[model samples]
Target chain A: MNERQRARRPGGRSARVAAEVHQAVTDLISERGYGNFTVGDVAARAGVADSSIYRRWGNLETLLSDVALTRLNAQSPMPDTGTLAGDLRTYAAQVACEITGPDGLLLVRLAVALSTNGQQGLQARDELRDERTRQLQSMLDRARERGEQAPDALGVLDHILAPMYIRVLFGIGPLTPDYVDGLVDRLL
Target chain B: MNERQRARRPGGRSARVAAEVHQAVTDLISERGYGNFTVGDVAARAGVADSSIYRRWGNLETLLSDVALTRLNAQSPMPDTGTLAGDLRTYAAQVACEITGPDGLLLVRLAVALSTNGQQGLQARDELRDERTRQLQSMLDRARERGEQAPDALGVLDHILAPMYIRVLFGIGPLTPDYVDGLVDRLL
Candidate 1:
């Protein structure tokens, strides 16, 4: 490996620690649900000291927010199908899969629980929404450039994203392929 | 007073205890969020013995479910405007108010947190959904009786209720009257 690459190794100790801690948080949320565990519990599960966790994340909420934001950004890259309908359908379906996965509902519940917390929690919620909105705006802007009629970013959020989120949040029903496509159809 | 009438007074001891316990749960959820408080905390706040609460609700989740269900049922007796469009708009507006009210978001977050707990938590989630569906069904059935083109109850849930819920849960934006009406208009 080149000297510069060696200095910035991807699998460094810090990266390994972060991965372990995140997995610990995810497992705890799945097994016990949100608000039922502590930072020490996470430390124990990850085989790290509580002091190390506190030094890095400073608090439980920050750690939880990091775990959620990291997973969300990593899950679905925005779709670019060269057409608005195709992009929307693909995007919605990917989201359905992400939220229905093993860690999906647990992470979602964590985000919701954090948003109701305090000022810090509010900031985390805003950051997550802004990230999702930014991704959607990029897709819509591309459609506009190609002379396609694209809906507003907020419209997509209300009609497409909101329904899926509410369904997963309340266990309302399954996000079938047809249902995901239907949301995109209705939005268009 | 008549013997039976006196015996079944509205302000009897049982009713008073139930109201106090419900109020206490609401206050705790508002201050601490779900899963942060326990049955003993609720009992202490309600000024009732722990045994009393345990005897009535069986557990913390059940007590929380009771609080949410009672509040939901008590709010906004489903609107019955003559036409489908009118009924939908009115009903949406009422729900907008209910969910944005003091105890609204707290109760919603509680239901969500409970849903991820276990089998008992799943039951609480199902009961909440069933109650909402039952309410929507009555309105749609009335619309059909009047020969109006009524969408299914689930349609109203997806198009109207889900958007408002997601907005509140994530602190996305305000649920203005124009926005609420737009959802109903789109659904119709």
Candidate 2:
């Protein structure tokens, strides 16, 4: 292996442990939709010592929050199509696919439900929003600079996002690509 | 006093009982949201016999759903204005006030969280939606007949309602009169 490659090698033993736990969180949430899984369940599935998780996250809810935060922070960068209409349609469609699906929707609901119970919940939710806000603001700013969107389009992302979430809340499903296209067209 | 009035008086006893229970449900939900109040608690607050509640509504979730449905069904008729825009604005604003408040948002979350548990949650949510669909269809039909809205504009009510819920989800309170006005104006 090259010297540079060797430098990045080995996230090491703790890293392996963390990676396993992360996969377990995703697996369990995907299976149960977030309302029922417990920390001990994650511990057994990850094959990590229960003490390892307890030392790091303290509880199931915080660990879930960490997993969610990590996913959001590591989300793929927004697509950059040439036109504002194309960019927004692509972005909105991606979001519809993400949140309308059973697993993705549960993650968000978990965050909201968690926040109602305590401070860690609020912290995780706020952190996620901060990360998202930065991502959204950057996308909109680019649109404005390209003269593709109106100057005032800066704050309009939430308006577009609102409908997709409503769709999830009411259990409206499979959010057809055509219907999401309509939402983009209308909001634009 | 009068014979016709005396004939309507027999509803006095049972109707009073129903009204008391309804008020108790509202009070408890408003006080602590809907995740925790018990059937016994509701009975005590209603000052009606526990047997009466059990005879009418088998469970707390079902009883809560019934209360929400009755209130929604008994809601005042939509306002009529000279223009479709005016009518929509007035109607949308009214809905904004109703759901954006603390109690309204909790009621919705309760249905969603309950749905995680079993069938009663789904039934309650479905009943609320059916009533809303009927109401929205009628209003949109009137607008279409007047040529204020296109025939296809029928399904757009959800898009309009979506933002208000998002606002409530994040605890963004007082969904300002102006903000809701902006939503209607933009969607239209």
Candidate 3:
């Protein structure tokens, strides 16, 4: 099989192994907490040798970081509606949905686990933030080029999007569509 | 001793115990990962019984949540200035200072760990957010009453403050006073 096909196949050995490993890690984390799971547990659960897992991820932090970031970044990009409000509404809706989804739960758990690690957690967090900011910035840049945004488009974007994440992070108010619309309208 | 005196005594028995426990948890989390630290380790390091920690916090999750929330809540309230911009600048400066301070490090670490736990971290997180939001809301409310703020003062508050927390949580950019001022000028 070609690379793409091999990667997709449920029956393929490598695909099965990777899936098993991912599921094992996820389950272990949820059941045992981030402070309890070990590399050996992951290897045994995945039925792979410990060396194989180590060679792939180098360390547990790197492995979990990859898992968390990949899941978060896998979402599709925001659609452009040629208007700032339209674009923000679409972006906010997608983000809100994700925040209430399984991926959001995983991210919350990961945040708590990383909160005590100082530099290690901060480094991983910076990378995650950079990725999201770059995506948001690119969208804002396009809006500016089209003359469809205000002079403070970046500031507007931060105002509009930041609250949704905060609400999700803090488990405060609902991230409803109406809330997103109100936010976009006011900022725009 | 009075409650105030007990709280202020840096070298008191309770203070020393808390310090030792915090350090132990921090070191274990950094060296062996959050999943590796155990109640036994924490208790032994604190020179207290495991039952004592459990009686106080109930579980590892609850204990960590309390630790994280307490640190964030202990942050000083925003200073009042006649202008919204001035108040925001002061608030942002304080936020930046705290995030860069030792207590800020502890809070950030906890935030990362809590990110993946979903609802597990919501109670503590919500308490912190609600307290800050109330302070900001009151400021905006006063501004509105004084005709200094626009009709949608709450919107302005969210727009200004949400982004700061987002930047801090994600580590996307510096939470400098200038950045806060720019945000206030644009959004407010």
DockQ of every candidate structure: 0.57, 0.36, 0.37
Worst 10 residues of 3 chain A by lDDT: A149-158
State which candidate has the highest TM-score. 1
Model 2 C-alpha lDDT versus the unseen true structure: 0.68
Task: List candidate 1 stretches off by more than 4 Å.
Answer: A1-14, A31-63, B1-10, B37-59
Model 3 Cα shift for residue A166 (angstroms) = 1.1
CAPRI tier of model 2: acceptable
lDDT against the true structure, each candidate: 0.81, 0.68, 0.65
Candidate 1 DockQ vs. native:
0.57
Residue by residue across A1-188, what tens digits does model 2's lDDT show? Answer: 77546534679666687789999999987676564577788999999888888877887777877787677555534778877787778877777777755455565476556656567666666665566667767777888888765423324444567766666666555578987788777667
Candidate 3: TM-score of chain A is: 0.73
Residue-wise lDDT of candidate 3 within B58-85, one digit each (tens)?
A: 6665667655555555574656788766
TM-scores of all candidate predictions against the true structure: 0.84, 0.73, 0.68
When summed lDDT is taken over every stretch of 10 residues in candidate 2 chain B, the lowest stretch is B150-159
TM-score of chain B of each: 0.85, 0.75, 0.62
Q: Write down the DockQ of candidate 2.
A: 0.36
Q: Give the Cα error of residue A68 in candidate 1, in Å.
A: 1.9
- For residues A35-69, what per-residue lDDT tens digits would candidate 3 score against the true structure? 57788999998889998778667767666776676
Show pairs that collide, candidate 2. none
